[model samples]
Target: MTDVQPIVRLAARGDGVTADGRFAALAAIGDMVDFARDPPQVVPGPEHAPPPCRHFPVCGGCQLQHLTDTAYAEFAADRLRRVLPGLDPVIMAVALSPPRSRRRASLKALKRGNKLILGFHTEGTHKVVDVQQCEVIDARLFALLAPLRGLLSGVLADGQGAGVALTLTDTGIDLLLANVTADRLDRIEALLNFADAHDLARLSIEGPAGTETMVERRPPQLTMGGIAVTLPPAPFLQATPEGEAALVAAVLAGCEGAARVADLFCGLGTFALPLSRQAQVLAVDAAGPALAALNSAARMAGRRIDVQHRDLFRRPLTPAELAVLDAVVFDPPRAGAEAQARALAASVVPVVVAVSCNPNTFGRDAKILIEGGYRIEALWPVAQFRWSSHVELIARFVRPG
Candidate 1:
């Protein structure tokens, strides 16, 4: 009859799963589901809590808000456990960022007549949710939404839409507007006045001529490990400070006592700048703008960091070059570094730290290193993008003598 099937856990996409294998949305652990009917019905259980944000199951920003704190943390940890089984890797910690702590976000804005709608896209759809309040982004950033909508109403043409990427930097908010046009000079003036009124550190617009900076009161910067990195326009910044700290700490722990290190895919020198305080770090990445910014910051900070603008996938650091470094740290994008991992496997570097946002790719890379005589020592999972299936982690490996 399937009278009552208790939901035991949550799936990767935030859907609750029953012990017998039924999926239900907006269901949490300890919830009871009745699958006897044509469609299942979910009844909230003890672990279910009220979602803090008004927009839940609608706005795509958050997914697991209905889960209690304990359950939420468990869900994040399970993400890693599912990938690395029987390895018994040391679990250092599972750091979770608090609500309203995210420093960077990209939102969609569509102008419908005189009204301007601004918020995240609806779950799995291009339709905008028009969020009134967000639980995952900083309060300072959320406060700008109303004012931004007001300004966007005038900037966007009828039925036109734009994408806004907002980041909270050291100086102030850095905003990048995409698909926005200013046919008249007054539109440009309005943008300048808006930046002036809000004291924005920088404001850039993407039009037919490409991205053009409208205002820059000061260079937008973000301090990582005591080094000030000048952020490039729409550069990749860590979503949460807590998640970044966890990753840096893990990387530094793995890199302890090394005189020389290599940071591959080093975006803006997140780990390189900090490791430079002790070791000589050579930062490599394909991103020219990011490398240029990192190099400038290193020069300004008087740190011994060599920035190399090279695509690792196309031309990974060979075993000979990697052999010179005492240790290596690579934080590749979601698509893990396959060719680079193979190169690293053949290298004689004693220690290697792999940071990734995707568990599947991390596992594949870990397998390659393990087969090449590297021992997985520690694993630290970080829930930087809170309440979502997205997970970031740092795995430390050491080659036996």
Candidate 2:
């Protein structure tokens, strides 16, 4: 009908919003909606594209797959813009990773009678999608799902499920199965055979006692900044390589001429190892194993990266300690580095690059820094979790006189 209202934008949770403040599910920007019915009907628009994945709508992995590239980017950038309304920082183009680029994901594998369901949980529900196909993960990763289902079905009894984490490493896929038991000897043998046949780099299972390594065909390593670091089991890493690069580039650009830099909350030296090329870097994190791996990689490469195993949340570097560094870069987890940001605000550090996956926490931390006399110079959003509400951003801040 001529009275249809067009969806103007996508809300924070991936629902399309109309100018009249109505929300429609699975609708995209520019799509027309007929509000005459009790439930509005969405008519496809030029900005709406067919979702390539057969598992769309059913699979909870992605939400904005129906939106065009331009529309998707806008939704991500709008998140940051809305958070910092007062500032006009340079907003960089969204770095959207292509479909099937997700390097790591945790999947649920449940065995029911003769059938084994393996994939993401259903949208807002516990039901498994039993993914026949996926578009959000690497082709190599999706290919392994079928084999994983087959292998898991052999050991997982009916009514039982295992939390499976698969990560693509330098050598091969590293798998970690939680809530797994080897009470039956045959299951243990089957697991070993599966690892060998699939040439998995490492396979670890968790049971009542503790986590046990079933196979370590080769050390699962991730090479970053020319250093080969053997990652700890299921370590936190960038969801996509493209997103990591974008964050690294933003951090580097912000710390261009600094002589000494401190990488706070540095997990596995993602930025520390790379920033060390131009400046001496002090890498700090609470995870001892991660720091150990980073230190080992630096030593093997003959690079002197100062690694510290300390909890920043409990004992963030003080202003006196932070004053020594020319610049600082912090990539905190989703909860963000609130106390650390406060300390940085009080410090004499000239440059800071903040990377975060959670925009809300980022906004909170950014405000703390801004109040502490730091000016946001650049903002870049990396949509690695494509088509999802999840957004990652890198913000550059500089201390002004």
Candidate 3:
């Protein structure tokens, strides 16, 4: 008889593990794994769920689709606990974004003979899955897939490939095509006609030269706080609107009663604009276009936000410079804000809100703050990537008054 082991928990890469140090792909918690076979076989458990999308386990877009919502939330929270084992902070419940809420996605397109394969790449491979339907992206974005296929068929030569970046803004879909040429007059006219026909807010193409706006029926805009800011070509945005709201709420809660605040790495002022309503805000980022958009929006709305273009990674604000701020909110990229967190740790800032998409990096920064006499008051695990293994979080670290 083959010895069976019960799967205990999910690993960082969405693989199920057992107490005896066995791993099974697509296995859920409470599932039984039989190890007698060359490769272990997973028996469906109570926590197992039927993936809503038919492309599950094939498309690299999502990983934990086999997990029930409850189990998925638990997985997200468990990931956080694993990363920050020694830090006993109050971890709030996981905030999971609903299906079809993703506002942006990048897809691949390849023309093979008369057929055009367009979709996300398969896991661990560059082969495109040719998605017929997707449950992750917004319905509006998915609706453009068919139209894009038809358009690309005429533009792409056999064996040629291109990249498609789709973003849903307040006005409409903002589309950017990469590695595709539109030098010919007919191709340029087709692009313009396609933009007009589809009612695209903006359409741009990136070729050997650079990005050129083919058409801008309307400025692709996003309303942050109450200010409408023109979105630069493919600006960094939160995966889903719900996730952004949750992060913003957590940050605002942490920085409550703050008189002066600095929003570090504030891309297009998602949190800075809202934080400015009650406090004086200094928004800083490395991207000039994002800062320019934020500055324009702030000026037009009569909101006071001092926008500065500076790379935090290269030159993080020093402890002396941070002394004047009542609160500091920094949402760095996946690399996390190591240098900025160190500066905040050594500073006298009363409230510090650290927003991160990677738990491992956040854990390292949290320890640095703790070593600097700051206590983590609260931590919120946000599953913005939904069924994927990625997990985002917002933590509050404060120095005792």
Query: Considering every candidate listed, which one attains the maximal lDDT?
Result: 3
Model 3 residue 234 lDDT? 82
- Give the per-residue lDDT of model 2 (tens digit) for 160-252: 989999899989999999988877889889889989998999999987887788889999998888888898888889999888898888888
lDDT of 2 at 91: 94
lDDT of each candidate versus the true structure: 0.90, 0.90, 0.93
How well is each residue in 214-332 modelled by candidate 1, as lDDT tens digits? 88998999997698999988999789888788889889999999999999999899999999999999999999889999999999889999999899999999999998999999999
**After superposition, candidate 2 runs with Cα above 4 Å error:** 1-3
The TM-score measured for candidate 3 stands at 0.98
Q: Compared with the true structure, what per-residue lDDT tens digits does model 3 show for residues 1-401?
A: 78789999899989999997778999999999888866888889999999999998899999999999999999999998998777678999999999999999999999999999999998899989999989889999999999999999999899999999999999999999998899798889889999999999999999888888999999999888888999988888999999999998998898999999999999999899999898999999999889999999999999989999999999999999999999999999888888988898899998899999999998888888888989888899999899999999999988997
All-Cα superposition RMSD per candidate:
1.3, 1.5, 0.9
Q: What is the lDDT of residue 35 in candidate 3?
A: 85
Ten-residue region with minimum lDDT total, candidate 2: 1-10
By lDDT, rank the candidates, best first.
3, 1, 2
Query: How do the predictions measure up, each by TM-score?
Result: 0.97, 0.97, 0.98
